[model samples]
Target: MDSIEPRNIPLTPGVYLFKDAGGHIIYVGKAKVLRKRLASYFRPDKTLTPKTRAMVRMAVSVDTLSTTSEKEALLLEASLIKKHRPRYNIVLRDDKQYILFKLTKRHEWPRLTLTRKVVRDGSAYFGPYTSAQAARDTWKAIQRVFLLRRCSDTAFRNRVRPCLYHHMGQCLGPCCLPVDNARYRAMVGKVELLLNGRSSELLELLQQQMLDASEALEFEKAAELRDQIAAIRRTVEKQAAVLGSERDMDVLGVAETSKGLALGVLFVRGGVLLDGRNFFWSGLGLEEAPEMVLSFLGQYYGPQSVVPQRIVIPWALEEQAQDGSALPVMSDSLGLSDEEVLADSDDPLAALAEALSELRGSTVRIGPPRGDAENRLVTMAQTNAAEEARTSASANVEEILAAKLGMASLPHRIEAVDVSHTGGRDTRVGVVVFEDGKPAKDQYRTYAFTDEESGGDDYGVLAAWMRRRLESGPPWPDLLLVDGGRGQLGAVMSVLEEAGCGQLFAVAAIAKARSEDSNRADRRKGGVADSIFLPGRMNPVSMRAGSPELLYLQLIRDAVHDYSLRRHRKARAGSALAGELQRIEGIGPSLAKVLWEHFSSIRDMADASEAELAALPGIGPAKARRIRSGLAAMRTKA
Candidate 1:
């Protein structure tokens, strides 16, 4: 690896990729003046941080993608970072999409539902809630207060009678009953108001409605409205009001602690603190704060992500020239004339705001806090970030694990594997991943094995899984935990050794404790603890029964075990369905696969009409009729 010559780089607004000797991108960055940014890395006098110095040492070459403008460069950088996930970049490991509340607009009987994506489907979306549970809680609260339809359009159309919700007086039975359209529409309007954070106005309307119902002697209606008002009030009371006016903005606060750098964002809608989220990165210091902040904004507020109109940060994104002193014209370094350098050197803050404004489809303001109220909000955010950092630092889970497990380094990313099968059929190997002591659900994966490959042999399944895992390649786990004792560990180790990558990752196995009387595996009975065995070890590691490290491993083990069993069951069900479909005349594996892809379950297939079946890719009218009749006969036999 050799240093990249910065002089050869073009002076343009674009993204740069620093590739290692293996041609793998280790870092991705965007720069307004590409030559100047690259020069900083190659300058002898510039003292680089340890991380940067290491990145430079590993870099053998540089790749650049020129963009038309700085804003385009910013977007391109985020896209590349997400795709490549370079080692030196501040990658956000939480890949779960934000939750949104979708309200159907075109449907005559609109229903509210939670979705992870926002599409241009003529529906009103309310939020990008960071927590699924919080979004569900809010949706449930809204349902309790409003009598809107709760079923999907398909279920609403197919319903024969009112559901249990209607019986419980929670719904107006719009699906099967003649509910007043005007009243339902009005309720929908109120729900919109509540979601938009106009609860005060909605409360007034509800109060007025209750009075009118009382004057009309509609006692039940008036009492229901009163309950609705109370519920809305209780919900609104939970939010803390921090602004004098109804302005929606997001406040960002950064905190650097011994553990890492933590960034907290508070979502303020209509002057109330709706929700807040904290992101923490280990080993990052205050010196990288500006870059971290910029990267966070670019990654967090993605294309489908919701962007607030205003964003307040603790400090400026870039240091401004003080006392009206202008920056030195980089005509020579940038290979541009003085006029061009002056014109192209737009303030990074303004460019970022412009990019966000375009994404939001409205004007967006980004800057430091101005007034006392905003200062207080920023302070609150900073306090939250500091608390999060302190909590993360106190845990020290990785340090304890490293000491107890006798590992060469701290196991930051752990992957656990478990094999499941039922009498040599539908074998499945589930892999669960944990990063930074938390479950990374998106990274969890499952592999299937043929009956011949498994043969009811756990060791054989493990070996097959290891080979497939090796093929998948890097972003390899720090430690590989298997769900068996010495035999299983050996199987995995043998595969790795045979593949000539024995030292790629550490391997360990967990075995259930045996009962003394029966000498049978005691599955968590009578306080029996599981044993963990490393490769070539005859005995288990000495970890206390309820130690955090032991509990964490147990947690990972249980997760993979459950995931494997679920996958095994699903595979069995799918196999059974395919076999049954194959038994029918004129149906083969391909048609069965098509049928399975179209229908979720056997019951769903049974309920499909002939016309519906005929609409499938290859199933013609004759095959569709045969399929319908076959399913009907199968159901009758059942």
Candidate 2:
């Protein structure tokens, strides 16, 4: 069917799929009242994320699966999401870009190091500090307070005497010193507690120990303990601990944006907010906001995941009322009676809370946090999530794009270059300029990259254009944009560096993520992201889909692409015309033109006999034969 009216879908619990013209599912969603949720999409006035609007614009039909209960619908939706890996479903598995602290507990002398990935090894891992600087600050604090050994295993084994760190009082001089392993291990334990948001407990022990040392008249030991306690207290104050409970709780907050969805999860233990990690995802979809939030939590807290005592989220529980809508949608397969439904209908925390409680071997509370302290913690998480979303969703596109892509400054005067290759040949390069976020058409330029083979290497052609511009020393823009990815960016950066102007200007490269899968669903034409790649980063910097910055960058790239294509076509057309004239022995371009004017068509020329050709003013028998032969070869090749 070309269209699916909302009324045609089942009203009960189920999953829905929106398919494009090729019958490929672009978006997957679940709802308790299927028709109600999906109807919102077809309404013209309802605001939608840019990605969702794009999906709806492309959707040609809809499909659904009726589930007995909403929980079943949630389960089926999660399974389908993983199975199809739909482009619009923001399932988390690849969003882990946070810096973490890893300590190899398996090692005899473990030194904490920064890492981005957490493995299943026995070694302890803590933190997902959203940035490298944040992780570095935590490490610096530990060094200032703990004074533990800070050396690689190899260095620790090979040192002959106390190293500079030990002499500087930054390390305990474990290497080439009579150190007690028991005391070192105990100090390592304290570091572990400190890193995991259990600093209050460590502080209490430290204060007690300090008092004992003072009573024993050990003034130096007492002073050291006092310093450590102060360091821990400073860290706690900086983190903003609004709650005072020892129980571990994971406060959750999420926000949606055109760039993507951001979820901030703050780890709170021993009544202090130790650390928070923000996971970002692209594909801001049209799934029911509440159900999608539930799905995100389900995927985040897997069966094997360590469940905290509470999973605080900034969402209202819909199951609070006796006749709460969620109750009827739950399947009888779970065997819930009227009493059970009301008992947990406050279950607006959702069914996952029960599962979490079972997994944690204790009751787990999941709901909109109550009380000033708990609410404040949830608010903190929400603030982080909202800020992250703003970075992607900001209306200040140019400024936000500059910040998101890690540019040196706002790209007020920007220049972007693109390489156009047709049939993988006859390449041309174009440079498009934007002044104050608008195209500066008079400054645009195009060049033919006629290096027979260089046309295929976008990097090589971009390099050539960049090198030419650098050598000639034209007025530089605040930022330079390239139409390819990391490789082209690296080439352009190298050219600028060789010219001694690498650090003088900012540069970034944009590449559209191409699908290797030829299937229609994987074939994202206008919908695919044009990823921006910057220097010194392994991952491409992300900008929102419809962000002003992205729109500006795309506009420049498109302008350049259009300019290059025009030049390439003109060059190819000229080459074809020249090849015909160059093939004949005596007929130069002028003679060919005169002959062409006389015949008016190649067919007319081919039809004329050799004698008629010889009678023409510039055409003799020898030249006529060559022209005839060349025409014969051209037709044969065709």
Candidate 3:
């Protein structure tokens, strides 16, 4: 390791990286002034924490990336930390985007749908709901009240008859019915108002509309409006109101325990507690709180993330002096003029707010709690964070498994793999991930295999998956659990050994229990306990039937089993659709694929008009007529 010269570092604002002997970056930090910050790290009188001292000893060199302003440095630091995943940085591991209610208002008959990703495709996104079930419940309520279109664009364009929802009066069936544009647009406006948390205004409008309908002797319409008003009221009442005025903001709280530090965020929309999220980092202390808060804010509220009008924190957003040393006073040796030093001293908090405001396309205020209501919200957030920390400390399922199963380390990130197929057709491999004893659904993946690749065998499927997994590389699982016995475990180990990754992670397999006498799987409840097989082990590991470790593995296995089966069925259905389409005259493999891409089901294709068919690439009027006739003839025969 070599000492970094403070004189050589720039006095300008920038981000710095500390690299170890192997040239691997272990830490990343941003600074108001690079020279002062780097000097803080190397000062002899400064009292460094054990972690900081260890990092400095391991570092061989430091690299600086200069930026025009503190804001630019902040953005660059977050980006580099995310890309390189430096060891010392507080990396937010959850990459899953929040659920949003997307209203496709650009369509003639707009529909509301749930999505995890947001795009600029003329759709209005309402939420970054932490709970998917809550978003779906709201969406369902809107659909019930508004009777907006429930079908997708393709389904709406191709349908010749109304769906069951239209018959049940849950939808207007704009797909098949001649609905008035003004009426539908009015309903859409009401939905937008409701989703925007302007429920009071919407209720007033609905009440006035109901009165007008009653005055006009339109009793049915009046009754419908009355029901709609009631439903909206119920939904609003379910949300606990914490303020008199409609204010949308997020409150941050911090909790520190002997185990770790936890940060909690409470989302308040229109003065109501919408939801809350908790993040915990074991072994982190209050001393690291400033860095944690900044890093979390930068990573969590990224581009496409929802930014509220205001953000309330438990404390001031001020930088802490590193290693008990005050910021270095500007000196001639540091190579900075007075004007340059003044320019670099811009407030970090203000810069952060400006960056967030730019992302939100509006002003974003960041500060401590302003009043009693906000203080209460922050207190609640802190309570939640503390409770989360307590719960996390109590739940040591991974540690228990590591000890019981003789694993080398705690399997914090476990992935279970299962292969699904029907009689060696449409083989698919599903992978489910568990992080810290809970499902990380966003990391779950499914891989499809053809007969040529997998040879219609479980071993072949596992091998193919292993090769692909190797190519994808790192963030590799701590434990790989397969849904089979010794043979499956052997197959996975062989592939990993061949690729020189056998020791990279532990491997195991699960097998259903069989009746000892009959040698058949018992159907009765608690008839037999399942068995687990470890790599290079001759027999199953013996354990109680309902032990937590066994049950946890079973839970992961069941998830992958269900996931893989669903994917296999979906593949088969797609194959059936393609087969049916290719049966039509003047349609081949390419044309069938194109048709499938446009229409999800054969019924949609059958219901499509000749003009629609002709509009498809490689299909002109003559072929369109031929294909339409062929489909009609096939329908008649069926």
Candidate 4:
């Protein structure tokens, strides 16, 4: 059968490898004592799963990576496992998607922005904030607090006019105006300190700035500064202060129920629990107590993003902590000696057995807490794990949305459309998709109106786009959303009915408020109150704000607006280019195409000399002179 044998290597602190019968390294383990530790796997199984038995059956040979101490071995184990991600090991897949604070470091006045991806090429980064809303709020706070530059590099370099951001008090207009480099760098340094939990220092500086502004009779600016300082102070005061604990510490707690196992981690940075997350895995078969804990720790700490000064785990991880391959241990409380702290003599089965027995409503035994403090911490860990599990369940959302909206389905997929243009000048349509209550960006589409009556005919633009979409035959959608009230809906419904596709999907229209302004901040201001006009209903289904359906509806509308505006802007640029080229006597559609392809842009064509224009494929010397003259005339007018 399985012909694997232990190397019987001395347990003088080293890394060990377990190879399957086929000589594939199935699992790698480490221990302080070479002989006594490696021999424990052969003992009678307590509650090992079929998977563990299978792994054992495949074990053919053992290998070791010798080290001077168990700590070194433990260190090495974590490194190798991170590199390999062995099958038998626990894998914690934490969502890496987080908000990033991007700063343009190359510019003299770097702009601060919130982005999803971080490129670490000398730019400053702060965050991985839990939510996009939270990130946006923080960004707004930063702007009010420190008026950082927000322009793009190209805009900053060539800007001649102060933009709207300057008037709104959001940007300092450093792009066009000169700013002292020393002062700008100082602000950057203060941002670094503020993010690093030195809010006290930042507040002091803000206080002085506020005083300076007030004394200079800049009352409005001083009031704004005061508000910003208060916001920063309020946020800092929310940080939880641990009793006599160092600023940096990672607290680990493990809890298990019949449903699965949970590892709850509390990361304390600068003595504050800014954020935390939970990890859970199906506990099908758990044989060795230390090994299970070891496996979970390996997966949890594999990422380079988070590393703590000290770790507090439930059980000893000696074999794991040795060769820098495992979870490093600051200390262990078991009766094992200082040297044996990293040894494999400790057994946790008795405590787990008692806990499981109690959980099963039977007599059980467990390790007594060293003190009440330790016991309370353990309970807190268990509560945190349970809460994390409950919060992360995806099933409840569907049921909740259904009950709230009285809908057959959760309305997981929604399609929204908005038509954009000024007086139908550049009539363009935007289509947006929302899936599972969020905007599904990849499914967004846009349509530029080919035929439309000039000046304010919403129905005409919508009808054209609708007809084109039907003819083009894009993916059929779960729902069709119209941005206008009755007019847009009537046009869309009529087109679909003509195509014999009226009953193929749900159609609804969201109309803006008639009396109240559409752009107002008041949620209730917008109308026909965002009424959902169903296919047959002469009116619309009205829902209250904060309802899940209402929230989902708002997201769809917003996404469509964003898409429509972006498409409209691009179409406007294209139209402007075409109109400019059309003015040239020699530039018909063919000559326009040649000029567009040759120069790649309207600006380039306009900037080109007569010689460069003559060098183009179809432009003769006489035509080039005409082209240059036309461009010169447009530039003069502009």
Candidate 5:
């Protein structure tokens, strides 16, 4: 389908995109010599990596956009990749799936849900949590400290009776009961206070309220406040100041292996190390240190990225660490290849900083950290990256297997897929990873189906999920292992075909043997065989259950199932409990949701003064009183 002949192409600097049959852009690139680069794909005798061949095969058309110079083309290519996320442009993507806690004011009970992106929607999003577990722990603590509903709108609507969470005292049975809207709103406030990292202010307010209640002879209210104060203090004491300055900055450190380069970003906010992230880049020929560093800076500081006035690279502090000794001696220790020598006309780092400065409407500096304390911080970031790359040296797994996987070099990364659901509800896809035969736990990601209708369709769920992931692009695995038989394997292959990156990675499927002639007793003992299915094969490749390849596949499958199943159960339970708040007479679904977002719990919502309740739209003075009366009745029932 690739109909364009290379001879027809003009020699010029420009960016080009390869589009699939559906007119979807699959790959984006830039070329100083368009004819030469375009001709390389058509050369029959020239050796082509499987990845390049795959792109060429699926591409039905090539669309070119000419630029004035190569630098302009380079910048345009980066921007297009960011927008289109063509699968081949892996060097600039950071799709690590950090957790973001979302609380929407649109709901009556604004319970927290972990989301991936921070949208401009009115809801508040707190965190770039390094892992889902960290976000889970924070959400759990918030629920434990303040009993907010953990159910979804759908679950809340269908409840006939209070669920386990309500009985366990983690939620007030707002559904199927005469619930208090005002009290629920208060619980939402407490959770927000904790998430906003205003624990000290929260503690002071609780203390003041407790004192007020005591003076009013409300002993029970005072006691509850006292406990809340203690909990806040315990949480606040755990976050120690990690830096000497309160100025916010991003610290960058680089680690390199012969195979690839890794960059560690330490997010320093209010001088506290809140979260850390690592990004990897390879195969764009970033062999030279300066070019790699510049590329990293450009991609990282692009328009959408959050930026501070100053950026610190570890090598910037290399000289200071040596107490003013020459730069070269310190550079080597920091994994920096050479002194800050500028050989090329294109100053990408400067261009990046300039673009950032334009966006920020202020000058932004990209260089080393300034003080003794700052220098130590940069060193810390560098060390973190070094730890990640230490294992990268072993990223080259068994070479034979890598070749089979159709990798350009060796398989440094492998991602396994598993989908778990509860009766077409809360379906979640798990993307688990292994690097050089060892687990990469931080990279484990799960995507829950947001559509209720798509729960039962595993093939559809996976295809859609994989497509979205690839479109976000990068950190693409060298190999893929689907947790099913040929059906799932074929589904994955078809998805890769649609994305135009099928030949880039090796693909396989793992399936448990059918009973065939075996009895129930044999099945119970794990006597059934495991099958490994490779692409282009009619039947699964033969491998014994005890074989290393089969066993490793089993481990990956087990982990994905476990990881996804656990989250599914929790989400299902939460969705069921959150629906309860809508039962309040004065509040409908929309009002209930907003109230949930605004207030933390039933008690908080019920205790809110009439004036405060009136401030919320649609809740007039009469409805406010009704809300209070309902809360009082619910209080009596509980």
Candidate 6:
């Protein structure tokens, strides 16, 4: 495959996908010079890391997409990684982007909200904070300090008066009345500033206001200001440290070992380190540490959100350009200028040499960090990196499942399907998608049973719905979960074969718990145990009912069932209404619905003359007379 050819590849920026013999994508990468970068792999370079060597050997074909720029490539890479999650790529196992605050601004008054889910509607969003607890705490702090409401938009708009939050002084009532937009905007600005680490500036302004109020003998107002000031001070003081004048800088520190590498990036904002995250790159060696860390930083910090005014690194690498805000790479030499250290540090030849030596599992001694401050930064980085690697190495649910099941990669994007019906009346199928081990409700789909009878046709219903889904233009999943055993699996296989998508997706089935000693209902006491069935497998895989994976699967199945049931009820109700009206001889659902909407009460229909009924759009003279006669005759008989 390597000898096949490397001709006619574009030199533009883009993400490249490398696949193995089995057509599974093994590696994904973004490159500035796609042709040049890809050509290097086919070159006769004998020295490559064990990981890269394995990736290269598996690489039967390479695919590329042209992006506008490197930044575009980076974004495309992240998105592709999210979609396919190639095996030899670094996967962010945890969903760090879930911690968002959704402010229900469509209300009469804007409210503070903290949520892990975000829909890309017109609503205001405040974060991708690392921690849910942190987001909640900040939300509470905003409510206390800013006095914003916390009610849903529906409740907020319809409220006749302020609620308990207002009486408790946690909200500035805007539902029943109006607040100046400028004032509210000012409060929002202050909250933004506080969140963005301009707390000191906000504190100084509040202090000045408090002093002014005191001088004016507005003691009550002054007291409130004092309390707010105190609260802000307490919040900031909890995480305080004396950062010497380096206002906006990012500290890059790395910890390397024989097995892998861990990189810690500390983002310092306005003289305070706001947050730091540790990343683990498995199977990387120590000599390759500098280049690996450099590559990761260029990719990770290159995103707009984390780019700081200055970047402080333990060492520099090839691709970094010279800038005034770039800090010196720490070294043993005492007498050196920052610019010279930076220029000398970023030599690409050194990085390549390091990468070669790194494959042999040998430790290369770099310069020692100077001063306690520098050492502390390095220590924090090392500690965090080690802990992060340890945490990742430990027993993760997805990892365990993948290893045990011999799957291609971690089963993150799981999909579950279920059917619901009410005895030959209303039937439907539910399709739900789960991402990063949680429900992504926006991707949920439903299919009404149009091809089969409402009930007693489980296999037929399943096959029809599966055919519809295969025809639908949604992305194929990593794993498909069905809420039944072999019968259901067989039904779906027929659909897959008919639709010609047999090799496009993986399939699994979850069977309901059966009783060995007890009846089905009695088995419900400890909750229904479930057995997962894989395609072509005779025996089902047993899992504890309350385990995270099983529970997650159950939740998806239940969601589908619930959605299907809801649709079934609606369909049954509509069908019953249609049946009742059909007894009138000429009226079907469309005409019955028209008469029902135009004249809500039967008495109103009975009172209408033939001319009046004929004036209705769908009702002609004949139908109008029939309606009038039917109503009158029924009333007379009664």
Q: Model-by-model lDDT, in order? A: 0.80, 0.69, 0.81, 0.62, 0.66, 0.64
lDDT of 3 by residue, 1-638 (tens): 45566567887889999997656678998888887666656534355555576677778999999999889998998888766656677877665688988999888778899998767677887776888888888888888999988877766777889999999999988887889989999999999888877888999999999999999999999999999999999877767878777888989999887777888998887777778888877667787787788788887887767788899988886545443333334334575444443344445578788899998779999889988999998899989999987876324677677776688756767899999987788899999988777788978899988867766789878988889988876566778999888888888999999977777778889887788899885534332498889887897888678977788888888888889889899889988867877888799989987887888766677778889999999999999999988888877777
* Tens digits of per-residue lDDT for model 5, 61-175: 9888887776567678777765665655454445334677788777876677888665555676665568778778767767777877677765676568988998997788787
Compute each candidate's TM-score over C-alphas: 0.86, 0.49, 0.81, 0.48, 0.53, 0.65
Where does candidate 4 have its weakest 10-residue lDDT segment? Answer: 326-335
Q: For candidate 1, lDDT tens digit of each residue in 149-191?
A: 8876656766789999999878999888889998899989998
Off by over 4 Å in 5: 1-94, 105-111, 147-193, 198-201, 204-218, 234-238, 244-250, 279-367, 391-400, 403-407, 412-550, 554-638
Candidate 5 to truth, TM: 0.53
User: Candidate 2 regions off by >4 Å?
Assistant: 1-17, 29-94, 153-163, 173-176, 253-266, 275-288, 298-307, 316-365, 370-372, 379-393, 398-456, 459-638
Higher-ranked by lDDT: 3 or 6: 3
lDDT of 4 by residue, 1-638 (tens): 23433333564767777775544456766665765455445433332355555666677777778888665566577666644434455533342445667777776777788876655466655544557787687778777767787765645655678889889877767777676778777777777767666677788988998999999999997998789888787666766654234344456677765545676666555545655556665543333335666555544442223334444566444333232222222222122333443346354233333323433234433233334544454466657976776665432444454454345433445678998887668777899876544565756888766544525678877777788878765334546778767778999989989987775556777775444556643334333356666666775676775665565566667778878988888777776787668877988877776776576565566667677788888888898988888887877787
Better candidate number, 1 or 5, judged by lDDT: 1
Q: Give the better candidate number (4 or 6) by TM-score.
A: 6
Model number with the top TM-score = 1
Decoy 4 TM-score against native: 0.48
- Better model by TM-score, 4 or 5? 5
| 416: Cα error in model 3, Å | 1.9
